[model samples]
Target: MTLAARAPVPGRFRRPRALRSERRTLHSWLMLPVEAVARLMTITWNPVDAFFEAVFWRDAKRPGKPFHGGWNSMAGRLARAVVPRTRNGAHVVMQVTGHHLRLAYVSSARTLTGAPGAVELGWYTDLRDVTWIRDRSDVVGGNHEIGFVDGSWCSVHFVGDGWSRMPDAFPLRLSHLDAIPTAR
Candidate 1:
């Protein structure tokens, strides 16, 4: 067969275009950082582990604590809202920062929960610290940038106003795509 019409014949060896397409698309995007991380021996942001250590472990230390329960309740609501109406599910990653906490899910289609889902609550702590909570757009690191694998789904949510009020002044963002290196 000619080059243009060439195919991977059953008994013979030929490179598949689908394989090339996969490499050029999602696989490449995901692996670029993996390769860089493997070579450089560094991690820019470990959101998954960071969140578990920062939030989950703290909650386990104090069962039914108001803050813990509130976050869990909000997370569950966000998950139910963003997850697609299919057999597949999503992974939700929530981030807490000085200004506001943010959540983003990686999914096959865009899932956005705007103002209607926004809820604010206030309370006073025994430590005399006042608390203000709400869904805020402010986020840091790769907390907002979600990745999707073909038909996979993902999402995120911010539960508190955090330690600050002004949103524009916060310096947080998703990992830059250009900063990553390629893998073999």
Candidate 2:
């Protein structure tokens, strides 16, 4: 047969079998590492929600109490990620979920009693994308308060609840902070 008149074969270019095998191998290797990391970094909104509900809102089994400046008990809860300062006292930027509400409370400094710690307790509400925070006690007064909780914006302060009485120092910045291991 002359080269110019030769017919082309229809099935010669197809390779469907090789594509599936390559895809399967790639998926198997990627999945192993993905699974381990997923388990380590998994954060459930349920634990955070339940803790806030039990402490602030005070469900039926637990009655709410009254405090000084505003709300007497916890009413709601939301998720928060805290980034602590390094050993050299350098403040790290934390990815707080709310607006510019990413405030820090360092406790390593000594207080009036000559102690080397501080405690911070507050009630916060997450509405859509905005977050409202209210101190549980008067430990932090003027500098932290906004105004009265009327039509104007302000954070509530509690008077006498146990949570309202946070120590002047705390070891960790946030109670819910946990470390997820990284793979080598």
Candidate 3:
């Protein structure tokens, strides 16, 4: 006797549509409070950080120490108060150039890992990278995110209005950078 061939059943290996939709809805509801808290922090703390940066840390040139005085001092306490607690737990410098995205941090004795200065560079051409840039505002400071091809992403949030430039720094040329195609 010959056996009859049968087609594979649909939705056998995947979750049901209704269940998937319900999970998505639950996830969105859970994330609403988190997003709200982040926005609240941005609105309240950004101005405070900006004021301290403009008045107290204006002339400071040190790389590791951003505050004018030591961490125990009043200026330092006020400065530190505005810094948002983040996932990485490190103060990082993020720069996006034409060819690469760079993340550098100065690690001191206070750091949890106790690692020293470290630098990480990822070339855009090597990965499918997407960047999200948020413009600075009076209440909220500017922030950026870089999504890599490996499904990993990094975000950087500024403590103050980053538009202000020091006299020695070169002028930002937005027009030239905008002309280049960023697609992978």
Best by TM-score: 3
Identify the superior model by lDDT, candidate 1 or candidate 2: 1
Candidate 1 Cα outliers beyond 4 Å, as residue runs: 1-67, 70-72, 77-184
Tell me the number of clashing residue pairs for each predicted model: 14, 13, 0
lDDT of 1 by residue, 1-184 (tens): 0110111112112111111111133444566677777967755377888778777675566332111112123322232333222112223334434544443433222224421221212111121111222222233321222212121112233234442332222342223332211111
What is candidate 3's lDDT per residue for 53-121, written digit by digit as tens?
878875573222111234333222222322322222234443445554333332211323555433332
Error of 3 at 13 (Å): 30
In terms of lDDT, which candidate is strongest? 3
Write down the worst ten-residue block by lDDT for model 1: 1-10
- Give the alpha-carbon lDDT of every model: 0.29, 0.28, 0.32
Q: Return the lDDT, model 3, position 107.
A: 25
Query: In model 2, which runs have C-alpha deviations exceeding 4 angstroms?
Result: 1-59, 64-99, 111-128, 131-184
Instruction: In angstroms, give how far residue 52 of model 1 lies from its true place.
Output: 16
Candidate 3 Cα misplacement greater than 4 A, ranges: 1-89, 110-128, 136-139, 144-155, 160-184
lDDT score at residue 127, model 2, on the 0-100 scale: 28
Candidate 2 C-alpha RMSD relative to the actual structure:
26.0
